[model samples]
Target chain A: MNNELRIMQNIYYDNSATTKVDPKVLKAMLPYLENEFGNSGSVHSFGQRALAAVDEARDKVANFFGSEAQEIIFTSGATESNNLAIRGVVDNAIKGGQKVHIITSKIEHPAVLEVFKYLEKNNLVETDYVEVDENGVIKLDQLEKKIKENTVLVSIMYANNEVGSVQPIESVKKILKQVQNDRGEKGLPLYFHVDAVQAVNHLDCNVDMLGADLLSLSGHKIYGPKGIGALYVRKGVKLAPIVFGGHQEYNIRTGTLNVPGIVGLGVAIELVAKEKGPSKLKEKLVAELKNISDIKFNGDLENQLPNIINISFLNAEGESILMMLDMEGIAISTGSACSSGSLEPSHVLTAMGIKPQWSHGCIRISLGRFNSEAEVEPFITALKTTIEKLRKMAP
Target chain B: MKYTKKLLEHFQSPHNQGKIKNADGVGEVGNIKCGDIMKLYLKVGKNKKGDDIIKDIKFETLGCAAAIGATSMLTDLAKGKTFDEALNISKDDIVKALGGVPPIKHHCSVLAQDALKKAIASYKTRNS
Candidate 1:
């Protein structure tokens, strides 16, 4: 058994942070670089070919999200997508002579929450954090109570990256529909923005079911290249450009198109759609880990995205467990992808009303397609041994 | 990955585990929230030959396996050593006892050393 364990090397389990680029995605991207290098904006045969590549990628992305090809605005990833969505709405609302207000959740990824925090601090917008339950689902009554006549936008996630909790976006859309009918307003409809970075391939995503006016997704989160993402701006949902430059992504994002990146993202989305996604490893891992004593799952396991598990070992520190796991060649995360490398306990846990002691003991294990049940046994055995040893060491 | 033979020995069939209920000295270190806490109990002093060696050393730890393994190995390292000499044990020596820990958990072995210092300090304070 020991000899078999020695044969293993580099057990990469921290897929939620990022994934190794798929070979197919890489193959699609290669031509745009070394060989087919040309600025998409230049007006020659080379440039026109590059421009065609960009359009092809855009159409694939639009098909992936059930949106029009023109609606997909390329940006630097989910962070930029979120910034563009929030700032765009605020800039447009302020210009329309309305006091802009925003409603978000306590468990929002920092990309969305931090921007709202900055707005609230600067008095640029009135912001309200609709509280989430232990599973990190926003309370509909609380959301309704916070919404005012001036609420220009409501930002939420299609799925949380840390705990994999899927939000009831259809329910949120229903509430928004009721609010719109009560107010008798047609023009300047309330902006619904969904950060679907983690949901692109794992779940069946459609702009209609999400009922979002704007959707943000990153390429790297779904086996595509990093540093590139798309923002879905529904037609007639007018938002001023937050990033200034020459009209590149239809005057919405003003920069030369990242041709290789777009191609990779398109390939990733197409493969997932064609293959119908094979991420059952997440459920298998979670089911096995659930059998352990003193282990608590952090989110709504039933309705989760089937790719993440946030677990806490009683009387065990996450870093200590992580170090030992690293020794065993099994990789894992502490909590949020954005908060990696920071020693602070997860704010997501704190928001769920988890005790501070429990927060420090938390470990986030996200599964990817590359993982298999054959690889999971050693992880469980290693985790159990590490936890038992740590418990005995504590005073 | 297989733990080194020494680490597994310390982890599986560890020596000097549990607490000495009437311990002559006790050393406790690390904050509760950090999740690594170690308490060392020592029963030290002379034999009929006036030897100053430590008679018995016991530990109760609440932390990860490596920490427990280190704590377990630390006691074995200190046991039977001359009372004053045992106080001189360093983190390097403890890591050496377990065939070395992964770099990140070097602090756990270090904590065990600090705990030994604390236990020795308490013994001196009580006897004086």
Candidate 2:
């Protein structure tokens, strides 16, 4: 009886890492996973039923982005989607005998940054990284200056995963519009791609409205099943296939389709579309946290996603705080070098001009749709106690 | 890397935390850039055999779980021992007492050993 009383209730605030799969989405995917299972490519009644489900999912995903069904290409996840969008376009440009110069922001997820680095190292393309401001937003002037006449593609994330800063996609669209017109006069091709994995939950994602030639999103990040994602390739944007197999996903990505995952992704996107505005719990938590001394918040709070709150506690190391919280049945993430395999802290914080000492003390608390207001007070109480304990132990 | 159950217990309720007021000797090692800093305090006095002994020891640390656990274990090993015996306490001893830390955290035990040596040296320097 005493042991049962000592058990702490679990509270999860790591939604930005991944969300719990919704029960409705799982219900929608059950038929496809069980008796309705069939290879979408086979020629029979079972195959036709499976193919119809895939087509329905495709249409739902396409409708979410205001694109045609043929434009959406399913992949494993956002990493694959990002790889497909970037490598596919750049490889096509290279095959056309053009010297490719591509641009990406310094604060992009490694999926995009590492791909650019690989291309640059191999001499396949000339790459430039546009800088971000102190709030982790991309600098528009720097982006414009980095674009040379030979630049063929630019990739930027819709929202940063670590700090939750939302980039100014509208301003970026305007700049690209001007460049596109200039390049069009010379019959040159330039494309814009966005990694929208973190933005679909809270932001507008209509492909034409964002003026993106290609866009990437992951199912897991939006409360759908894992191992499924999609890429929005605009009509007339040519891309070479990176993975070779049976002709699937219009030859851009190949393999047997993940029918259940696809069905879940479609239902997840539709559900998030009806989700309400900014979370009041997040606002309350931030406001309460501000009452504590020696705490600094990262990123532009006004423009950031409603779910994420990144903060650094002076003198208290992040990994220590994270472990303490974990003991209390609360889950969070940290940017401390000690927590990661590599000794360096978060690249996003470093790119935003934060010092290593401050970056090592950073922790991220992200709320999800299923999280309730009742969980906030307990979390804050636990956090305050943990910080006090750590502060007392520190030199 | 995962910490052992023994290490987590030490981190959760560390031994002899905070400073000893007007300590006989104090030693601080590591730096903020490395993401760990350990400050050790010692109270040295003569034993019945007329040999210098550590009467009390405490530590304050700003680091991850391994750093704090290593320091806590070091204090437990060094207290009530003569200065020479305390100085002989190795990194392996502290690591062994706490089961073991991750390979990447082996430096934390090294830091603990260095802190003990520095404290003993400081006591000798003031008396000599």
Candidate 3:
């Protein structure tokens, strides 16, 4: 395709994968990338200016989460932030010779899920994966039943990356609080860690309100630059350092700051606070898609984030649909095994008890603030054509 | 996964797709669990030399680009070949004809080979 034609036809619906950088964020970051390049650790004037910028960015992020600036630790991205949050708490307990029991939901993003799996495989921690209902909402009762006296941390995502199911965070907070009160300091300290990467753009992330001891956020998911994210650790939470390096990010995460990315993230966070949710476009898209037959929508549509929609078209394989859409310059994602180059389909759908056949046919359409209503009809028209073609060829 | 332009072209516009009514033989391979299925229809006829040849071929596939493209390529290769020649059309040949598919998608071509073999075996059993 020619550049002009490609640009004219392109429509991106893969915001859950990553978002285009906001122009405002890019503008804010350019000065740091070009002129104000200095290590925040240095004591020179140039370093002082860089340090000031870092502090300002930290404050902006902290304010958005209703957390103290000191509580925020900047890391590479949500994957790193998740590692820091999950490993930091669990590792600290292990160092104290404590028998750690940790809990996480089955439908968590691999960033959080894999960390728990690694701990279990190494026998370093006893882990339990709380089940999710067919809608991919975590089972609160199962979570309550699985918490042991030694349960140190419970990691759950605020909104699932694939399905956009918003977990019952407030209820989870209440349950954890009651358990803590009942245990009354005799039991191991239990902290609630939330992977809020997908929720920051549309949900309230106040740390106190959510009762989150540690929370993870990604930059690129919120229209900020890639390779920069933040972890919020509450005032009294004690976490061991994951990386050893110069005293940076409260020494919890050690690396030279991604100065430009941090600046962009701060601006992006500020912008998202003012940005409207994609509910109107989501409603229009979903309603139009429902007219198609033999399709099942995944996730709890009533409780999900408005940005993401997951659906399975019976008989139409997801990779074929994705490829067909790609040919039309409409970008989307699929949960099919072929797309992942694995025999197993999407773990999220599998955990939700969706059959392999249905899971292989699933595709996720995630909207963003930049997506317009004008693009919706064209996307639906292309999708209808793609599904019809694939179904006609299906065996 | 990256697909060659040739493979993408075939996927976009597959050759001789859909079922042939009253086909001489029909075969289906792969399963829903593995997320790929290819069904091939064959019309076998006698050549001037009194040898069996594939007179017509068509396929319907529910799979990724590689599966669809490979099946399309298989039909092109087997359309006018003698029974022995069609039976010798291997997965490698299909892959080569499509430039190449990703290593993981090699199984898709394998499905195409299996479908053709099954169709020919069914046809021979019916005749005998």
Provide per-model DockQ scores.
0.30, 0.69, 0.76
**A317 Cα displacement, candidate 2 (Å):** 1.1
lDDT (Cα, tens digit) per residue for candidate 2, span B1-128: 88999999899999988899999998989754457788999998889999989999999998888889999999999999998898888888988999988988888888888888888888889989
Residue A366 miss distance in model 3 (angstroms): 0.6
Please identify which of the two predictions, 1 or 2, would achieve the higher lDDT against the true structure.
2
Clashes of 1: 14
TM-score against native, each model: 0.82, 0.96, 0.97
Per-residue lDDT for A1-395 in model 2, tens only? 14357558589999999999999999999999999999998889998899999999999999999999999999999999999989998999899677889999999999999999999999999999999999999999999999998888999899999999999887898999999887676566789999999999999999988989999999999999999999999999999999999998988899999999999999999999888898798889999999878988999899899899999998888999999999889999998877877667788998999887688678999989889999988888999998999999999
Name the top lDDT candidate: 3
How do these models rank on DockQ, best leading? 3, 2, 1
Q: Model-by-model lDDT, in order?
A: 0.81, 0.91, 0.91
Clashing pairs in 2: none
lDDT at A353 for candidate 2? 93
As for candidate 3, its clashing pairs are: none
TM-score pick, better of 1 and 3: 3
lDDT of 2: 0.91
